[model samples]
Target: MNPLIKKLADLSEKKSRLIIGLMSGTSLDGLDIALCKISGSGQSTTVQLIEFVTAPYSEEIRKQLKRISSVENVKLKEVTYWHAKLAHLHSEMILAALRNWKITPEKVDCIASHGQTIYHYPARDQQELMDPVNSTLQIGDGDHMAVKTGILTISDFRQKHVAHGGEGAPMAGLVDQILFVHETETRILLNIGGIGNFTYLPAKNQPKEKTFTTDTGPGNTLIDSLMMHYYNKPYDEDGNVAFSGDLNEGLLRELLNDDWFEEEKSKTTGPEFFNIPWLKEKMEKAGINQDELDPKDIIRTASELSARTIVKSIQQQKITSETAVIYVSGGGAHNPYLMQRIRELMPANEVKNISEIGLSPDAKEAVLFAVLANEMLAGKGFGMEIEDESKFVNFGKISFPD
Candidate 1:
């Protein structure tokens, strides 16, 4: 047998495994490296976030990523270059993080990389195509990561979901089902990342089909873009700009008029559909001239749009559980104004940061990918069922270090 296969078999049989999960969301902010000690698999899975850190992307790196990320057109060479370049960069960040944590690569079992998403053309967004199909693209090659880091790597996870008849996103639902389902409380694991999305985990006794995940429109993407364009900041820190500005009801309504909101609950989206251009289009439709409107007001309106769409999506679920909990995570959790809006809109349900559930909100996305890699290695069922038999297959593609 190949020594690599033998090593993988041995690792799967271990009592516990140390895995590094990497996530770089559409925000183009940085890579989230989560060093996790995960044990068991499926419903019995346990994840201890041993260490977590955000490896900040330099402005140069951010610029390059933005050029290729979610844009309608780009030079093919740029995508090809970043695919490998980003993986090496991620590998370096991981190695540096391990050193900072006083650990070594050999001590880790695997690396689960949710590579940088350059384009997420879900079937819904591909109307122009003659034969549209659900598809998404994430760079940072697993082969490069595995060879450079000398650790087994699992990357390009979304393709499997698309192949299995999913929109190739919001993969968080599977992990949430395995790790967060409650005995009596219907929990909504809301992640307000570059694109807002949530996993609806019905109480343990509920039917499986009742549990699903969907993108709740823009999370921080629009607001972050506005900040960068206006304030020259990466994000609206604490959402202060939004809090200080007055909301434009017309603009908010126009933004909500998008047909995407009315789509099926189990769906996915990305910045491609909810960027600054999209916001400006909505603004134009609302008759709000960019020259006259205060940028802060625009930011405020965008923030409200995010909050309203999120609330609207949750309400659309028609969840009968008045006691359901909305555990918020992602960069939006840190934005007090955004959280305040969500809390206000969702008064009945308890709205709390995911830290209340014992996982760092910042580390949750990265950690979940680690759980996925663990499941791929040693798990039986994915803890959920879909009509597609293809969905039952292991998610991440494996890359072995020779």
Candidate 2:
């Protein structure tokens, strides 16, 4: 047998494994590096976050990524160069993090990298295309990561979901099922990142088909874009900007008027769909002059849009009778106003940070990728049968260091 295959087989049989999970969301603010100690697999899986860090992207790198991200056109050269360049950059970030933690690369079993998402055009959103298929792209090559870091690497996880008839998003459902399911309590794991999405985990006793995951429209993407345009800040720290202004009911209604929100559940979206240009078009349709309105008011309305859409999505799940626990994670969890709105909208359910359940809100996404890498190595595959008829497929393409 090849030496790499032998090493993989040996690692799969181990009692536990050390994996470094990497995530770079649509926000393009930074990369999340999570060092996790994962054991078991499937429903019996357990994970302990050993170390985690957010390596902020340099302004230069952020500018380059933004130029190609979600845009209709771009320089192909930029994409090709950055694919390999970003991998090396991420490898350096991983090495620096390992050094800070006083750990050697050899101590880690593998790296699960959710490479930066440049474009995410689900089939429903790409009607104009000649081949409108469920498609998504995340750069940063795993082969480069493996060669640079000298660790087994698993990357481009979304492709497998697309190949298996999924929209290649809200992949969290698989991990949430394994980690958050309860015997008697239905749980809603909400992640408010660049895009707001949630996994509806019905109680173990409930029909499995009732559980699914879907994106709840815009999360922090619009608000973040507004902040950068208005205040030169990457994000609204603590929702202060939003709280300072009152909501515009007319604009909010216009924002939500789109038919996309009325569609059936279990769909996916990205910044490409809900963006600054889209916001301006909605404002124009509402006859609201951007120059006349206070920037804070617009931002406040945008924040409300996020809160309303999220609550609406959760409510659409028809989860009533028993109060479900909604554990919130991602950057939006830090926004007090957003959290308050969600709580106000769902008074019966418990709304709390994911830390209440023993995971850092910021590290949850990164830790999830680590859990995914673990399953690919040693566990039986799992899936939400009702959402996609495709068979349960293992995610992540493996890259061995030579």
Candidate 3:
């Protein structure tokens, strides 16, 4: 009988809700700002992606940001300052997008912001004895965003999952279950971002209709990092870098042996584990002897790593259903070489862009946060987390219109 719960119920029953979902992934390419119209919830939910685009980041901005992304020491002042700046910058972009689309903020009910994650240190770091579930930082301050944009904002989504015994990510799983679950079909929605993650919804008609989701392994993280590092490019366009290089079988074997693959990690990871240093370690271990091993091969291997990991995860599902339609989204979807490898690996599973289902692949993640924010404002939990360890929680903190 909480007030927020009642308010959420009211919103859910409303005829329409306009939400702004913002996502800027590990690629650091730019902001993916989306405006969406959504209604219903859980499997009954319907999402209409109204407008979407990937706003290009300036090279200067990208460089400054990259310097801090994986660096150990950063001025606390700088981090706090950028968090607010990010929110404000994104708010300006939102306003610009609204103007271009002939939309009004007054028409929107809420904004879902996946604030920039400067650093995400899950509980259990060795040096910090911070209480378990103590801290994880995502700047893009929501309050600043709300004040500047004059829109009610919801953000800080991961904190809730962590409070509830989850790793605080792969939150997209909640949205996936709500929007994609079908009664007779077993579905697997794969998102190949800087990392690869998946949600498996068992055939809904089965006696024990089940759902499980997990992060398999590296996605475009290493490859993209190498591209940025060696080619002065943000990412390997069309997977060309990968296609040009020969796959180092020995290197691939050594890279695959890392402990992450051997253990069971929940469907969550970020640049934290898979970065330039991690890649270099494996390459060094493999002993890249020949000059023939250009840095591009490393990129190609990483892409293949993502494709293979996803395929392996699907196989573990013991699924017999006709091709579990794999919907690709995030930056990786556009990588042709990566997609080809994925198709070859999951020949049975139909691989198509989210656009094929009426959602722009690039905008899917942004739209998801918007939906999550809507759910939070309305005060509804999309059921409990997948396991007993997680809290059956409703996420997002709201920043009201000024």
In lDDT terms, which candidate is top? 2
lDDT of 2 at 337: 88
- Tens digits of per-residue lDDT, candidate 3, 1-402, equal 877566556666786688889998777888998888887765557888888877877888777677667567998787877887788888998899898999888787888889777676665332556455534567788999988888878888877767777776777778887777767766777788887888777656764755777777778888878887789877888888889987877888987787667545454556877887777777788886535567867677777777777777667656535646777887888889988988887767787887776777778889889878767654346564464336454777877665
lDDT of 1 by residue, 214-271 (tens): 8899999999999999989999998889999999888888888899998755778888
Q: Which stretches of candidate 3 lie above 4 Å from their native place?
A: 1-13, 124-135, 289-292, 317-323, 388-391
Cand. 2 Cα-lDDT = 0.91
lDDT winner between candidates 1 and 3: 1
Q: lDDT tens string, model 2, 266-331?
A: 899999999999999998999999999999998999999999999988777676434589999999
After superposition of all CA atoms, the RMSD between model 1 and the true structure is: 1.6
Lowest lDDT 10-mer window, candidate 1? Answer: 384-393
Cα-based lDDT for every prediction: 0.88, 0.91, 0.76
Q: Provide TM-scores for the models.
A: 0.97, 0.98, 0.91
Each prediction's RMSD to truth: 1.6, 1.2, 2.8
- If candidate 3 were superposed on the true structure by all CA atoms, what would the RMSD be? 2.8
Clashing pairs in 1: none
- Best-first order by TM-score: 2, 1, 3
